[model samples]
Target: MNLIDTVRIALRALLKNKMRAALTILGVVIGIAAVTTIVSIGQGASRLVQGEFQTLGTNMILVLPGNTKRGGVRQGGAPTLTSVDADLIGQQCPEVLASSAVVWTQGQVIYGNENWNPKEMLGVGPDFLTVRNWQLEAGGFFCSSDIESNAKVCVIGHTLIPKLFQTTNPIGQLIRINNVPFRVIGILEKKGANMVGDDQDNVVLMPHTTVRKRINGSPLDNVHAIMVSARSTGKMNVATKQINSLMLERHEISPGDEPDFTVQDTTEIAEALGMITGTLTLMLSAIAGISLLVGGVGIMNIMLVSVTERTREIGIRMAIGARGKDILRQFLIESVVLSCIGGVIGLVLGTGASVGATVLINMYKPGTQWPIVVSIPAAIVAIAFAAAVGVFFGYYPARRASRLDPIDALRYE
Candidate 1:
């Protein structure tokens, strides 16, 4: 028989047992839907993380104090990094564009009767805003004079506005940190949240000198970390290496010995996060793929049953001069058609599910920007895999049906 005639006959046979065919397709649908949804969501999450990093500027590098070793025991991070190190890094590293020493403290911010606790209060150098690539909503950032003279001026993130100033203008207003009054010099533009959902706007920035001397009571040179910005994206690695070498030389650590500081660039951090997300996506995709195997098994089982049930019909066709190859083709086509239908339905459902999931997540976290990313290649592959599953599992049953003895099948009840 021609392929079209054979397909028509096979479809007619399935139509006679519509409920059975529908149930058989259910397994495939569930499997494909799960895989598609997982892949799409994974892609979206990866993109979101990369985008967050991009916002922070990929050319940025962070230098933090490393662990201290005493009596063969390792201690937590030591306060070895200082403002001098930050200054030297900017001056010595040719690839570095700017560097800022950062000192961190936590205190209640008060303005008149209103009092609020910020997530972080930082002492940063004059180049802090430049290194961070942050913009001002109003006023201006602290300059060299502010840091040099330890001026009591500060910049506040957007989130602190409602807590301290309400609807009143924040510029030039006095806000107290640990009862130490600081004149508001700038209002930072809103940064929303980081990739890990930390509120980026709930911060206060001051000169590193002011934070150390006035609030934390640390030495003039003391700093918690150093932030560096490379001259260009391609210079990040060179800048990181230069900083690391310069730090070791300054800290009096010998080459190949454990240094008391760590230099890490944003590119490395972004890659690490991307790797983590990619691994998770792969693991989840593998778990979801198990459903496809189960569905394949279901197809095999149902096809075997179909072969048995259609034995009489098969025998009549064989007796009427139908060939075994034609019978096999007909049965195989039926199975593929069934799986293809399920695959198409599942693709649609999975795409919708991914979008709905993103919307729900964004709704839950109002400022979040979870995205829906449906990969066309993934959809096409899912459908093709379903068709392949049909062929692989349907082969044995089709063979059995094709090989039925005409005399024996014709006499069967």
Candidate 2:
């Protein structure tokens, strides 16, 4: 028979056993759907991490206190970052555009008869908002005059304003932090949560001098972290190296000893996190793909039974002068048809599920570009894998049917 004739006959036979064929195809569909959905989630997560880091700040460097390792052991607790290091880096690093030292105090805010139980009160220099690329929707950010004068002025983030002031205009309102009064000078633009779920919008910024002297009761020169902005993306490496050397000198670290600080660039952190998430996605997709192998084995078993049940028919075909290879080709076509049907269904279902999830995430967080892209490579892989399963599992049964004895097959019940 011609290839088309063989395929027509095979399809007719399969159509007669509709339920069995459908059941066999179900395995391939399930396996493909699972793998595709998992990979989609992985891709979404990678985008989220990158967005979160970028929102934190661009081309920025975070200098935190303490050496990364202590006594050959990695440090566990948050170490103290002093204002001296922040000053030195600002003065000595030619590639650095701006820098700030941050001191924070957790406290309650009260205005009139209203009181906020707890709020994140940040003590930062005037350049903090600028380095962070924060924009104000209502009033101006803190100025050098505010920092130098130890002004008791505050800037509140979007979420914090709603919580403390409700529908009232928070600008020019007086909110007391730890019973200390400060005028609200600015309202920061909304910055939504990051991938790890940090509330970037719930914060209050005050002058570093004010936070040090009035709230935390710490010295004016003390700081917990230093944020530095490089002159440009290309200048980050030169800036980081200069800052490290300057810190080592100021801290009096020996040539063989590690410096008493750690410097991290935001872009570098972003790339590293991307690689980690990509690897994780690949692993998860691989695990889900194992189900495809199981489905292939199931196909093999079903085809084997199909061959046995059709032994008499095979014998008749052989007796009618059909060659062994013709019988083999017919059976192989049946298996391939089954797999192809499953693959088509799976592709549709997987793409639908991925798009649905992307929609939900975007709705919850605006400006989040979680696109549900159909991966051509993944679709090709799925289809090719399904075809491969058909061949691997159908070969034995096809060979068995082809090898049947003509006279015995025709006489069999």
Could you say which candidate leads in lDDT? 1
Candidate 2, residue 187: how far the Cα is off, in Å: 1.0
Per-candidate RMSD vs. true structure? 2.9, 4.4
lDDT of 2 by residue, 1-413 (tens): 89999999999999999999889988889888877777777777787777777677757999988746756787754455676677677878999888899887889888777776544678887778767877888997788788778899999888766677878999999899987899998999888765545577778899888998888886647688999989888999999998888888877788988666789888888889899989998998888888888877878888899988999989888887899999999989888888878877887788788888889877886556565667778888888888888888888988988998988888888
lDDT of each: 0.89, 0.82
lDDT of 2: 0.82
Q: Counting only residues 3 or more apart in sequence or on different chains, how many pairs clash (N, Cα, C under 3 Å) in candidate 1?
A: 0
lDDT of 2 at 389: 82
TM-scores of the models, in the order given: 0.88, 0.80
lDDT of 1 by residue, 301-403 (tens): 8889988888899999998999999999999998898889889988999899999999998888766688779999999999999999899988999998898
Q: Could you tell me which residue pairs clash in candidate 1?
A: none
